[model samples]
Target: MRALVLDRPGSFRVAEVPDPVPEADQIVVQVECCGICGTDLHILAGEFPPTPYPITPGHEFAGIVAARGADVRPDLPVGARVAVDPSLYCGYCRRCRAGRDNLCENWAAIGDTVNGAFAEFVAVPAVNAYRLPDQFDGQLGAMVEPLACAVHGIRRLGLLGPVSAEPTVVIGAGTMGLLMLQLLLHAGAGPVAVVDRVRYRLEVARKLGAAQAVTDASALGDVRFAVAVDATGVPEAVETAIGLLDRGGRMLVFGVTPAEAAIRVSPFRVYNDEITITGSMAILRSFGEAVDLLSGGAVDPRPLLSEPLPLEGYGDAVDRIRAGQGIKWHIRPI
Candidate 1:
């Protein structure tokens, strides 16, 4: 099997490696499509501390089941198409016990902490594999992972209650931001306002149902939203989103900001306005829901899909993502 081996930060090569053999409770998946994300870039630059060297980094992916361990569920037979949830949680951790597994004390993810699906074949826990509907291809299946993250973010925003029809503001019209915008609309959110520095992305946002798409929040002067979501992971964008919230509003920090980044927030305003601030880490129990949403066409992944490249072109894919050339770039590893 051939895999992208990151021998260390700033170095990687497409080399032949032994095919992964499933553990007692794991299954081997023949990789089909794997989406490149910001986290991959972090791992490449040695910015993500959890990542270990000499590993394959691709968490958002889907493929066909090639083999199964003896202890794996009998229901998941070989040849089944599945989308994997890469979260690797310690079931006994305090946070895991409390149903907040995303924040497990021993937090780890398949791609981040261990070898992942950026290869011809990868082994994953059988439990993390969810069967995709017959209608979903590898591209759509690969989208489930990121969509799951966005789903969890919306849940953190308290979407269970009645969502006010007031305009919701989504900062950053990138793939995640656009996905969040669509989910909000599907959940009955009133006219959404999307902000992005890229004019083309704003246009795509409008096509995705954003009532208004602007380069900056100031373009919609004095406009306040019941919910504001920051998907840019930039401190300045987060602050701007918070400032756009209305009284008694909620803010969801769904982006991965720098560990050293800090934003200025008025404590007095937070107290007086009854502002609620929360953050969503990664996928929780939302992977299945994301699959359903995608299958049902509630959220379209086509608009976000960019041209796929072969596994050997991984470096080019990274460059494309870093340059912000497209909504989502995928690697066809098969």
Candidate 2:
């Protein structure tokens, strides 16, 4: 089998590798499509500590079951179409016992702590694979992971409805930001505004449901927002979101900043204005919800994709994403 292996920081090679066989309670999946995420770039740049080297680096993947290991359930048959859950949590952990598996003390993400799906085949624990409906293709299935993250954010913020038509702001206009903007609109948010320095991304944001898209905050005028989402990992975006929130407004930080990145704000502002600052991490119970939402045709990610590239072009795909050249890029592993 051929794969794009990240042997070390800033180095990736496309080479032939041995195919994996599943262990007990595991399955071997023939990967069809995998979406390149920002975290993949983080790993490449050495932002996060490298997991085991020479690992196939991709988590947002969907494929068909090539084989099932011993003790596998007959219901989840071989040849079943599936999308990966990616998160691995020990059921015996304190967090898992409390029903917060996303906060498991021994949590390990599939593509990070273990080998991932950027290959012709991957071995995944049966618990981490969810059967997808026949109507869902690998291309659309690849989006389930990222969309689940957005769904988790929305739930964590406890975004109250009767979400006013008054201006709502979203900063970043990147992939997550664009998705959140669309979701908010679908949920009845009005006059939604998106801010970003990139003109092209702002244009894409507008098409995705942003009522107003601007390269500079000056264009937002004196209008205050009832809700704000900071989808850029940049600290500047967080600070700007804090300043833009109306009294009693809530702001959700949906982006993952660098470990060293810090944002300093006035405690008096948060206290006096009753502002709420919430941070969302990985998806919890929303993976299934995201899949259902996509399958139900409630949210369309097709317009969000700028291009799809084959596995051989993985490096170029990464470059395009790093350069802000596309909304999202899917890799065809087959």
Candidate 3:
């Protein structure tokens, strides 16, 4: 099997490696499509502390079951197509006991903490795999992971809270931001305003049902929103989105900001306006819901899909993502 081996930080190579053999409760998946995300870039740059060297980095992926361990469930036989939840939580952690596994004390994830699906074959826990419809190709299946994160983020935003038709603002038009935008609409959260520096992304956001799309939040000019989401992961953007919230407004910080990043906010205003600020980490129990949404066409994947490259072109894919050239780029390992 050939895999992208990150020899160390800032160095990697596509090299032949031994095929993964599943444990008694695991399954081996023949890689099909794996999406490149910002986290992968962080791992490559040595910015993500949890990642160990000489590993493969690709968490958002889907593929066909190539082999199963002796104890694997009969329902997940070979040839079954599936999307994997990369989260690796310590079941005994305090947070896990409290039903907040995303914040488990020993937080880890496939691709980030172990060899992941950026290869021809990867082994994963059978319980982490969610079956995909036979008609769904690996490309569409790969979207389930990211969509699951969006679902969890929305849940954190109080999706079932008192319905207010007031508009919501989503800062950033990247894959995650767009996913959040669509979910907000699907949940009837009212007209959504999308903000991105790129004009083309804003156009795509509009095509995907954004009531307002602009290069900057200031363009909306004095019109505050009842809800504001920061998906850019930039301190300035997060600060600006927080400022755009109307009195009594709520904010969800869904993006992964740098550890050293800091934002400025008016403490007095937060107290007087009774503002609410919250954050959602990675996927929780939302994977199944995301699969349902995608399968039912509630969230369209076509607009976000971009041309995929072969596994050998991983470096080019990274460059494309860094350049913000497309919505989502994937690696076709098979």
168-262, model 3: which lDDT tens digit per residue?
Answer: 99999999999998888888886899999999999999999999999978789888889999999999999999899999999999999999999
Cα RMSDs, all models: 1.0, 1.7, 1.1
Cα deviation at 292, candidate 3, in Å, is 0.4
Off by over 4 Å in 2: 160-166
Higher-TM-score candidate of 2 and 3: 3
| Native-to-model Cα distance after best TM-score fit, residue 247 in candidate 1, in Å | 0.6
Where does model 3 exceed 4 Å of error?
Answer: 160-162
Candidate 2 lDDT over 291-322, as tens digits, reads 88788876778777755688889999988887
Residue 304 miss distance in model 3 (angstroms):
1.2
Superposed model 1: Cα runs more than 4 Å off: 160-162
Instruction: Please give the lDDT score for candidate 2.
Output: 0.84
Model 2: pairs clashing at backbone N, Cα or C within 3 Å: none
Give the least accurate 10-residue stretch of model 1, judged by summed lDDT. 158-167
Please, what is the TM-score per model?
A: 0.98, 0.95, 0.98
